[model samples]
Target chain A: MTRTEATRTGLDLAPDARVGIIAGGGSLPVEIARALARQGKSPFVVMTAGEVDRISDFDDYEQVTLRLEDVGSLLPTLKKHHVTHLVTAGHITRRPRLSAMRLNLGLLAWVPSLLVGVTQGDDTVLKLFVRRIERSGIKVVGAHEIVPELVAAEGVLTKAAPRKSDWRDIDAAHAAAKAIGALDIGQAAVAVGGRAIALEGVEGTDGLLERTRQLRGHGRLAGRTRGVLVKCAKPGQELRADLPSIGPQTVEAAHAAGLAGIAVEAGRSLILEGPTVVARANALGLFVVGLPAAEPAHGK
Target chain B: MTRTEATRTGLDLAPDARVGIIAGGGSLPVEIARALARQGKSPFVVMTAGEVDRISDFDDYEQVTLRLEDVGSLLPTLKKHHVTHLVTAGHITRRPRLSAMRLNLGLLAWVPSLLVGVTQGDDTVLKLFVRRIERSGIKVVGAHEIVPELVAAEGVLTKAAPRKSDWRDIDAAHAAAKAIGALDIGQAAVAVGGRAIALEGVEGTDGLLERTRQLRGHGRLAGRTRGVLVKCAKPGQELRADLPSIGPQTVEAAHAAGLAGIAVEAGRSLILEGPTVVARANALGLFVVGLPAAEPAHGK
Candidate 1:
């Protein structure tokens, strides 16, 4: 169907129509926006509070501010701009206070979901967000869909490839990371010497790394310095929002935290500043590899 | 089978036969030894080196010290005492250097499982240990099998019961803890405000609690302190070894960590110093509940 036809009827349509980007924290939203704009499509961005959304850089798109609690106005805003497709990038770790939300018609419609979402894990809430947007006649697209280059490719992405020993750590971390995702706990897990040293929690990757670093050798035995940081999509995850991403910052943090390398899920993970990240990791003598989807069967 | 009959041959038998205790760290081994002695059985104790196992108080047991690397002596020692049944109690977080081992015929016999065990998580190694002992004509029993009082009881354990809101945190922590267990990563998980704040890693439950305390409010949004500490058995865990245990130390830590309560898998978990644990929990106004085996179906 034509874009105008889909917009006028306020019904579902292919992603070829107008894309609305709901930007959260991090540089992902800006990248998604630029990618969409480069494709000659207009994107109306709803910037959440505490996000790195400086929308003035975009000359072809419109921008609006929306607190997480004020999610009610999101639907009307999308409808007002004739948005038929939507994209959510970055993350929202802090939950919004229910009482503080504006409680508009759209938000009111999702009260049940939001109520359940409050006590649920990050994936469940993100899934709810996607369902809410899709229910409003907007199709949610992963930012990677708009820019394939952002998605990590299979195999090594740095000069220093993972050694044979590191593969064990990678597989271990990958399995633990998947288990974390399956439980909707988090996306990342740290493994040292084939043992999971830490799993990402609400405190995030940085905190997980920091705790691992501090507690590594603090146990009865010394913790190994070399480990792999595996970030992968949860077994059941909403791909549109919060697909695990790695940037130069992650590389620096992993290095600082004494990890030997970073391993991300191939084709499903995002690697921002890919070349810079690779070069930086190579400089730090750290490896960055994208693991294939079909993980080797764990022998244990 | 009669106790004497079972000890005569290299065959598996119930723990009612002659029992041997492999004591690691902490006071649990002492408790188990005492329980077995009270049951009119002469228990042989192999205290792992670096453990706090001073068995002078025991009048009815033979004791020997063995370094972790000297695992080869374990089987021979068990057979010398006519130990047809065994129990492993307490904790051991540090792994031994395989190269430093004084490999004996028994340790060499189980070298394959030990090699596999070295790279696997705690549960796998514990499972291997159980298999090694059982294969050597000795049956391993959980410490709880000797001391029924060690197992936690159902429902609120202290005067202070979990308030309605704490249930959400309990469920969240329980799910995360189980996931940690399913992956054979760790035994405990802490949640606050419906978010998994920390997961037990190699650092153990105490370390997990400490990290949660330090990183609770350190997240993007202030993490709620009114969550729970849930310690459950890992999926497919060999109940004979490393069943999650909490005690007065746990109560003190939970109180200091500012948690609302502590929840544990009722039938599968151990409560060391139960009266003191309950008393401390009550004094701190923190709830300690033995959660039922069946978890409420997670809404997510």
Candidate 2:
């Protein structure tokens, strides 16, 4: 919307540009769509049926539903709507089955890559998908590009600032997050005391927080509290899509897990609704801080 | 018990050596005790009250019970029992609370380190604990030293060997396990479709497997199977305590999680009741292999 603080990808949203959203299951897509609509650019919302959560929110906008197996037809559909730029958002919980795919002539060329990418890490699959869309002449942009205000700024956003002990945890969790990200594993980690206690896997951030919550008063972690949850981008990650993010739900999860705070890489991560997230965190007595991107140590 | 083989720490168990086991809550301690008894060595079992699970199994041996807070008195207690060799086995589910600790003169000297160590990773706390015991003239040995046969051999141990595709998962999971281990985080990881999907955290291996099981049919992991679970010792880890281990329970957990097989670093990791684990794996249609200690990848 009006070149919201030059996108990380250097994307320029021209006045006559048409936007298409490849929506998945999350409120982020809805937020992105709302931001575009408010700026007088109604987006062509596309949802994979059974994978999207906020279907009602996109009802006012021109929308279409496609099955997971019909992802092969998404390019043609976007082209038909004359989409100039694209934003991929939210989680695709339903995987595309090889047997169910309707591989048309055009889709056959890329189906092999899709099949291989699906078996790899989430980022690999996302990169291949984005490349396919970009190759078709529709530039793919991150949802943060549409809502710059949602990007977390450097500092503690909530009323409760992290304590000195929480800073150690922040450092520990950040290192673990980066290590896993480098391996294309996941994007979140929780640290208590002075070391990592939980790591995000394919189960995602919510699951990682839930596991940490359950670990309280068990084993060596008994009586341990004031942990920190950190989410950050993979080192040298593609900034177009799948950047690590947090929202009001993240604050709730961290609080539920008995964590002192939540930290995200400033400017590299998205805050779905900045005010709502801060308000929720403050209400829950959890500090939400945006950490500076760590400097490369000895050029690893 | 006489030495079965040269221990990783070069520990020698003489026939006259009076053994004491600081037992925690798992079958491993029991297995070690049984191995010692089979060799006609009656071990003195020390069980932390409310923390040990296999109490009945040690009734025949000279045993003592103490509260978790009384860990400070353990050195003097070992001296009283004339224990020359010590082994720490199993999981300590209950942490020693500082407020409840009976910090006598000897413990007071190292109490600060204990307090700091407990706040760090498991290895840090364990190294501190073992060093204190070693300072008191008792030699500590790994449980694998008691029964050399318990150490996994470098080969597939079940009827269901890993397929060619599973090898990729093995490499990926091994790399992830080593990465986390290097940070003193944990010792196990699960990789599916050529990338790590789950990692062991403070919740332990069983919890990791359970989380992996719950992750099935969710997000990108839907319909994925034949994953690999890998466990290995931490890089440059103190070998006398906390050697990564597996047993029949591990086999069951892996099978239940739809994993294709289980792998542990050969010689560095233990397979409690090895024959039983292999039989269980064979029956469950799962493979159990012991990978040779990974060569340093271009000198890490």
Interface RMSD of each: 2.7, 1.7
Compared with the true structure, what per-residue lDDT tens digits does model 1 show for residues A1-300? 001111122223356688888887777787777766655666788877765445555445697888877788888888998888888887666677665777567777879777777677667777887887787678787776676677788888777888877999998899888887777777899988777878887778877777766765664435355888999887756676777888888999898878899998776788886778887898999998888865421100
lDDT of each: 0.75, 0.82
Instruction: List where candidate 2 sits over 4 angstroms from the true fold.
Output: A1-11, A295-300, B1-12, B295-300
Docking class of 2: medium
Error of 2 at A258 (Å): 1.5
Model 1 agreement with the true structure over B1-300: per-residue lDDT tens digits? 001111122223346678788887777888777766655676888877776445565445798888787888888888988888888888876677766777567668768777787578667777888887888788787776677677777788778888878998898889889878887788899888776767888778888787767765663434355778999887677888887899889888887788989998777888887878887888889999988865321100
Q: How close is candidate 1 to the true structure, as a TM-score?
A: 0.82
User: Quick one: best lDDT, which candidate?
Assistant: 2
Which DockQ-derived CAPRI band holds candidate 1? Answer: acceptable
lDDT of 2 by residue, A1-300 (tens): 112353232246787799999888878899888888877789999987888988899998898898877776788889889899999888776677677777687568577667678656667777777788888899888766677767777888778998888999999999999999999999999999878989999888999998888898676776677899999999867666787788878888888989999999877888876778877887889988888876421111
What is the C-alpha local distance difference test score of candidate 1? 0.75
lDDT: worst 10-residue window of model 1 chain A: A1-10
